[model samples]
Target chain A: MELSNIEKLLEKYFEGETTISEEEKLKVYFTGEDVSPDLEKYKPLFEYFSQESTVAPTRNITLKKNRKSWYYSIGIAASIALAVGLFFTKTAPEPNHDLGTYDDPEIALEETKKILNMVSQYMNEGKEGLVYLKEFENTKNKFIK
Target chain B: MKEGAFITLTNTFKDKLFRLAKRLLVSNEEAEDATQEILLKLWRNKSKMGEYKNVEAFAMTMTKNYCYDKLKAKETGNLKIVHSNYQDDKPSLQRQLEAKDSLDWVGKIMNSLPEQQRAIIQLRDIEQYTNPEIADMLGLNETTVRVALSRGRKKIREELLKKHNYGVV
Candidate 1:
């Protein structure tokens, strides 16, 4: 009520001695339309606190936008990685070598020579059979005569 | 605890937890994230919440710790201050006309205070917490709480007076 008492309370308040109810009283007293000139300097501090009590914090638009972008960026990055992996995996072909290169050319030529020799032997055997047939026919004719 | 009790804790403490996080982190987005994190933590530790004698205070303490950890991470990483996207419904023309003066500057000034001092003021003045309760929440001695609050108020007063060029009796 008295200015000195109010001053003491203010001092106690600064010292964190005032209870919630006392602080509320101070808020009420200081917030009056007719604040004394002597206490005018402290008015802003109390006003700040009072105003702060009601001041809704500004919404963090950037953070929310960032979060959305973060998810999108991650999705894009994952897709790009997956596409690169698929391209590399699907487009590449397995290496093949010709087996003919591993064979000896001399060995192949010798095998061809052996096959030709076997064909000549078979021709000679056919000629010999024809000769034996002609000799048997002459012997039969002589015996019949 | 009972199902109803968990729901009651959330209902009762959501705004208070949000306010505390907002004050400590000075960003609505961070506060919301911090609130959700705190709530999740509470849900995970619901049994512990039930065991506490003062659930409100415990929840407040949890919120403060979570916000403080966020602040520390931001500082260590040198993260930029990110803005929030949450929209507020516009007030009516009459309400806007009747609105008080802008306190944004005041909030900035309060935010300029050291983390510990700012937290102490938030708990003591804004949250209407007693010194002992605040000390318990902050893991500081009650004397430290008083000192921080006193010093914080003095700094706030000095800053406000310097800006306004007025002397208190």
Candidate 2:
């Protein structure tokens, strides 16, 4: 009678109709000592399932601590420190325009020549006008005297 | 999810992930590494944990997908070989020596099964997940899960019975 009950459960189990409890019953019966001679072949199936489930990961899992709030605070502090540092660095230095200083001697010489040429050209133009002014002043003084 | 909730979730499902990985990959080092990788992924997505309705199912799905990808990579010879000192719980020597015993040879039958069937058997028989949960993990409907499970289970039984009737002992 008990053998017939196991047989029925085994049939249902193969058909995938056995509930968790029914399956548990089947497992208990199959793994127990004195399984029916007719049902001896089914013992390993249950034994394998039960044994396989007990297998654990031998390596220890190393999960990092979340510390979400702690990390958030640290992040905020770091950002604030960065903002403050940036503020000081930005304000401490006055905005200075480039005066066109050249470190290279060749570049300096070229720039000096270009400036001197511009100055000489302006001076010559001013001299030409001054010559006409001087002639006008000399004539006016003589005639008036 | 709460801060503590993510840790709690990983702690609960890590073993399942490892077991599922082993079932799919059939190697201990690969399974362990796969579990570690899956947990790391879950940790990276911890903020989105609340988005999943069933976190356990979601984690199982991830583990399955990761193992499949690993298997594919392995087939293509694109996988970097992972080395580890950890050993798997192999079938015992006595179990192997008992040539007449039908119970001990299930592992060989399981290994011969197709990947999908093996996965279904693992999730259903060993892990004891409901058909619906197995469906969600494998991305199949309940009916498909049931049918495949029945077929796989029956095939395993038939193979066992074949060995018994032949009496190799």
Candidate 3:
């Protein structure tokens, strides 16, 4: 391409009017060593643009690594909380052994006495069976005599 | 979109996304983080990726917005010159040093450009995006993009000319 043509393209480029092909022609001309001395000043600018493009960020960026995936963590956390809640709800309802007892001291004492008397009466009945066994043994002894 | 298609879409424009991030943030690490962030967003929205006509442009716009938010959050510090690729091995050490110096100057000048202009220049010149695409990415009209590009180029040219006595024998 003629130098004048490149000059025209550069003008359009500054105004942001150059088509992609025209800009390509400009980059090609400026990148070469044969540029007219007057145009040498514009070379670094184009070179900078090209150089800037070639610059890959020094590190590889893997998107998967940086994704926090908090939803999964939140799901696990919520499930654990629910399980613990259900366990506490199921096991925490044991009634106290003191339930159904009278609150008045006198009434409670009377009830205790009644329970004790019932236990003693049952013991006396058990002793009466021993007395019958003793009479039977005596009758046997008299017959022997 | 399917997972396979999502990956393909990302692979297609990942570099452009990274470069745009790098350009805006001026830090490779931040740019890498931004790119990963943008890609992850795209991955999550992979189901809706098909809704857009131009995924590449959409990704670029996302990066632009993300980097801007990061800037607002004060995540990136002062702009740093990252010119690792501008070196030429064939040149003499002295010429290489001179070129490096030139690139450093350009980087500084680029930093000095207004944020919008800087974005416009990078999209138009470095990434070779069309004016309409750049307009969409920056959320500006075509005329505004052109004006910003013009102003940015002129400033760089004027500064370089002042420094080097450009066009002098």
The whole-model lDDT of each prediction reads: 0.75, 0.84, 0.82
lDDT of 1 by residue, B47-115 (tens): 666578887788888887888888888889995767588655654454343323325545666788998
List DockQ, one per candidate, in order.
0.16, 0.42, 0.44
- lDDT, residue B167, model 2: 37
lDDT of 3 by residue, A7-102 (tens): 888888877688877887888888888989988878877778778878776677665574477777888999999999999999988877876869
Which pairs of residues have clashing backbones in candidate 1?
A59-B84, A60-B83, A60-B84, A60-B85, A61-B83, A61-B84, A61-B85, A62-B83
The structural similarity of chain B in model 2 to the true chain B, as TM-score, is: 0.81
lDDT of 1 at B104: 52
Docking class of 3: acceptable
Question: What does DockQ come to for candidate 1?
Answer: 0.16
Standalone chain B TM-score for every prediction: 0.79, 0.81, 0.80
TM-score per candidate for chain A alone: 0.51, 0.49, 0.52
The number of clashing residue pairs in each candidate reads 8, 1, 0
Question: Candidate 3, A139: how far from true, in Å?
Answer: 99
lDDT at position B61, candidate 2? 95
Q: Report the CA-based lDDT of candidate 2 relative to the real structure.
A: 0.84
- On TM-score, the stronger of 1 and 3 is 3
Off by over 4 Å in 2: A65-145, B1-5, B78-104
True contacts kept of each: 0.32, 0.65, 0.72
Highest DockQ model number: 3
